[model samples]
Target: MAEVKLFGAWGSPYCCRIEVALKLKGVEYEFIDEDVHNKKSPSLLKYNPVHKKVPVLVHNGKPICESLVILEYIDETWEEGPSLLPKDPYERAMVRFWTKFLDEKCMPAMRKACLSRGEEQERAKEESTELLKFLEGTVSGKKFFGGDNIGMVDIVANFISYWFIIGQELVGLQVLTKEKFPKLGEWMDEYLNTIIIKENLPPKDKLTAMFQARFEAAATATATAAAAGGGGGGGGAPK
Candidate 1:
């Protein structure tokens, strides 16, 4: 068997995507935890010089970075698991389209809401819900965006299943609810409750605390920057 090792962070949804892929494939891998806050590992830099981020998969001494790219790689290399992408080329393209939308639109908006305040948070929440609504329309009847079973779309949107909800709670907003967005709300519930997904999620309480800390840190950094700006000579010279 080719040696497989994963470089990941505890709270990273990106890392979880790779982990879920490996688990579903029944492939055993050594996990390396990256401390992204204080100091990133040299190997992470060496492996993924562009991003220098977590969820870098080193397989048989070669490194693969980017969660979505890593997922494609895993599916292609290991034939044991269910296919991540759909069979029909058009369906595969659609899956890729939705996956890209999640990464580019919905996820980033939710993230902004989680880490911002007041008007900015409201704007982010609004933007997030709007994109989510678009997604709901796109994958309306599908149990998972990838279909009846979990697939690439499901894996990429996994953040919506747990972290997005947790982030909403931590930030005190409710953009994704059953009443307003029935399809997305139901999909989140079903996607999350699936056996492999449920077992592999970051604990809710722990994720809450992590986001709480991040929110505070962002607040502090913003406040400090504001204070420095106010005190600096950028304004007209004081009398």
Candidate 2:
């Protein structure tokens, strides 16, 4: 038997990606829930000293950090299950390109749309919508990014189907809507409905509650910063 363990935070979409991959591969792993937001665990620190982040996969005493890296490792290590990525080199490269676009381009813009206010929020919303439009075209006439089944792109984009939806709802920011991007919307519905994905998802209510708290904290921080900036404009002289 192989010794497989995973260190992850419950609410993180990045961590959830790894969990979903492991499940898809039918790999039984011991999940060590770590408080990534509050305090770091000794084991987590030891395994991922540089990043000190969650979603670290330890297989046979060797640690693999980063969700995307861990996902490829899971797929490669377990050959019995359905392929997470394509075997063709060019096809695999395309998958990596889109995943990178999602994480680097789409996600940040969507997050900013939710966290920023006024002009910045509008810009972020526009950017996110444009990025999503590209994805809409990519997924057009397809049930999934993998053509008919879940694949690397679908797994990497897990955040869009769930986390981003909940976050945009909490902030009342609508960068992604079925009316605006129907193809991507349909893809989301299909991805979320898959038995494996549906079974593995964290409870929606719990995820929403967590997002609400984070949004409140961000609002408080922004207000405090604004107040401090206003107070500091005294021209270094007492009038």
Candidate 3:
């Protein structure tokens, strides 16, 4: 049996993070696709009892949950190749800080945009725009988040490369357009063009279609709730 195994879903950007890290580290692992939305496998539950989430990396029967944590574990375990964290303590701290920012602030905004409509959608768009602007400013003259080479923070923040673009298409928003956020847009191109990142990303049209279906399903659920008179006690119809 393979010493390392990864439980993941195809459409999950979280899963993609671990995949990229493992590939970058040149670790050979078994890939298990878990149906995150529907039913999870027994192994997934056994591995990650707390979150029961995908992207669980099981090494020698011990499981590591959370994509970021798994990346750190991989980095520490496999000391070969380019380092994910910076050598300097301050630079490493900055990387962690930005990665946390992307996870907490940027991801939430993007999720909101995915599941929202009307005023709520507008608010999400605004928030996403602000987050993108902040990221753009941070990258002002830097080649990558880790300065010269890609690091853990860059790998973690890479969801903005393909997933965010898919989110824009699915949610029918243009928050990260070239005109609105040119620097960020350029940065996205640069990131995606990188050898490791480019090779690991999912197919564009396929991801777009998957997200579109999810968006429509969420909208349908909202409409169904409104029809059943169980929607947040609103006077007007769903936008």
Candidate 4:
């Protein structure tokens, strides 16, 4: 029997991605839920000292950090299950490419849109929508980003199907919509309805509440900072 353990947060989409992969691969892992909003655990720190983040996969006592990296590791390590990456080199390359675009480009812009206000928020929303257009086109006529079935890109893009939609609603930012990206919306519906994904998703109500509280706290902190800056700057013009 293999010793497999995962340190992750219940509300995190990153963690959910790993869990989905593990389940898809029929790998049983001990899940250690971490309170990422507060202090992290010593074990998590020990595994990923640099990021000190959740979704760390510890297999046979060796820790693998980062969700994407861990996803690849799981796919390679377990040969019994359905392959996450395609067998063809070109197809695999495309998968990696889109996944990179999602994490490096789409995710950040969507998050910024959610967290910012005014011009900044508008800019981020526009950027996110533009980024999503590419995905919309890519997934056109395809049931999943992986084509026909769920694959690496589909797993990596799990955030778009659930987390980002919830986030956009909470912050009153509408970056992704069915009307704007019909193909992508259809893909989301199909992907989320899959047995593996549907069963493993975080409870919608719980996730919504968590995101609501987080957005509220961020807004409060931003207001407090602005008020403090307003009071201080009037008294001094760089004295």
Highest TM-score against the true fold, candidate: 2
State which candidate, 2 or 4, has the greater TM-score: 2
The global C-alpha lDDT for each of the candidates, from Candidate 1 onward, is 0.82, 0.85, 0.79, 0.85
- Mark the 10 consecutive residues where model 4 has the least summed lDDT: 230-239
Give candidates' CA RMSD values in order: 5.8, 5.9, 3.7, 5.4
lDDT of 4 by residue, 68-141 (tens): 89999999999988899998999888888988998899888877777766676788888998899899889998
lDDT of 4 at 183: 93
Per-residue lDDT of 129 in model 2: 88
lDDT of 4 at 79: 93
Tell me the lDDT of candidate 4.
Answer: 0.85
Model 1 lDDT per residue over 177-229, tens place: 77888888888888887889888888878878777777777777667767888
Per candidate, the number of residue pairs that clash is 0, 0, 0, 0
Q: Kindly list the per-residue Cα lDDT of model 3 for residues 1-239, writing each as its tens digit.
A: 44999999876788888888888888888899998777989999998899888889999989999887888888889887778887788987887788889998998887777677778778888889888888888877877766767788778877787787777766577877878767667677777898888877878877877776777777877778879996721122111
After superposing candidate 1 on the true structure, give the runs of residues whose Cα lies further than 4 Å from its correct spot. 228-239
lDDT of 2 by residue, 97-157 (tens): 9999998898888777777677777888899888998999999999999798799999989
